[model samples]
Target: MIRPDDETKPFVGRWNSLIRILLVESSVKHVARAAMDYANLYDGTSCHPSNERLARETGYNERTVRKAWAAMRGMGLAERVSHGVAHRRLSDEYQLVIPESWQSLPVLGPSGAKFTCVHCEKAFNPTGNCKVHPDGRVTFDLIPMVFCPEPRQRKGREEPWCATEWDGQRRASGETPWSQLGQERWKVFHLARGEEW
Candidate 1:
């Protein structure tokens, strides 16, 4: 959570360049921009805002805010510092790490090139052709939408090309993608494969 004192600090000018880069290159533009705005609200290394608060401030739904937070974390722009614990269920704390070192931002992969899945953080190579699923979903050889965490939500959004699966399963259950299993389940899956999240 941001310290009360940090709320009084004015926005720094150094974030201008970082914001510009995010506007032009980030696939999740609104979320990234909103994150910057939230960061600017305080003078500390972290900020804590509920999804409802973020939605109200950014004009995005809570689901979109959640996705944005996930995207930011996957892109190494922000990190979870502490989980919220309360009867009313407060929001988690997150540290915006990008402004401190924007010079080292990860580069987006070129067209048709192998890249990491921004959501699953796995490598994928696209075949350049999309396969239309029966449900009107589209996927590529390198990264199938079935293996992605938020295929429906990411339908028309610009995203990095990459492939991911449930680690050991070649095909995910149609009704329930492995990503919905939550972080603890994924960690167990990775551990079974001798890997770590």
Candidate 2:
């Protein structure tokens, strides 16, 4: 499982955010979950696992992984930055994108929007860096204590919800929206909530 405070691999926090708030087909979500293991440390976006590897990891067939990738592309959740060379045995490189639309949705445990920096009042991009100065100036330079979306400075008396908690309880209990519960249960929960499956 990915952890938020794994400083050696800072991308875990972004992957956590992706899984927590993802709203897509359950099958695609499963693929995405598996791909999280391969998120690059430089940024959470660069994923380069082969389709066969992803299929094996997700316990799905290669065909399923291909379809899932197509669905992810259509949904703007991921993009193939480089095609693999079959002769050279290179795997396709994909970048996982956090859609701007998703930034506005309410998180599972809090009323406030996801991906917002408490200090600067600006949304944190996928890089998990906050470039906004205290006086409201954005800078290209790196600054200390400027990480965002996780393990960063937050307002007094408020914190992000722990996504790992209650995964088997509340999400399985059947809830509305059917969007915050991560993978494989979306369709069931959606149908349970009186929506067409």
Candidate 3:
């Protein structure tokens, strides 16, 4: 299992805030409990806990857990065991996944939101840098972020969540975003205007 450590600490703090709070709300707490049950599947050996059993453990009504499970499925957080009969749930294979919207800038620079990567597993600092062409046109490089489901940093405390390196291929020569990232594994994050961001 991917134990939540310093590498995953930072991003989880920033990105998980809303989801954490939301997951604990009204119907959502059931969803959270179910997610935890699903996560238990990969704990040590494997868990195929039934949704029914999960409800019993979490104090949620069976029907309510079912509904919450469906909602979690839509959010890309949980999946059914087979066609759908079992209470056993499936978890994301990669375990960490960041959405594009979270890694993006709505309007180029400052107007954009900042996020940490689930894959790269780090939070970009000061300001999240542009992952695109520094030539002015905003490039959409894959920014490092988090899934925020594991043990992570608390709000008042933060750790590293920047992309030091990526697992995939390097970009073609002269490709700004890829090369810029290559300039240093620890990248100098900048904005669309190429200033400190």
Tens-place lDDT digits, model 2, residues 117-151: 32344444322121324443322211111224345
Q: Candidate 1: which stretches are off by over 4 Å?
A: 1-12, 23-27, 40-44, 99-197
Single out the weakest 10-residue window by summed lDDT for candidate 2.
138-147
Error of 2 at 29 (Å): 1.4
My TM-score estimates for the predictions, one after another, are 0.41, 0.46, 0.33
Kindly report which residue stretches of model 2 are placed more than 4 angstroms away from their true locations once superposed.
1-10, 103-197
How many residue pairs of model 3 clash at the backbone? 15
Model 2 residue-pair collision total: 0
lDDT (CA) per prediction: 0.46, 0.52, 0.37
Look at candidate 2 and give me any clashing residue pairs: none
Between prediction 1 and prediction 2, which has the larger TM-score? Answer: 2
Model 1 vs. true fold: TM: 0.41
Error of 1 at 96 (Å): 0.5
lDDT of 1 by residue, 120-181 (tens): 65554322222334443332232231123333436668553223434434254454445455
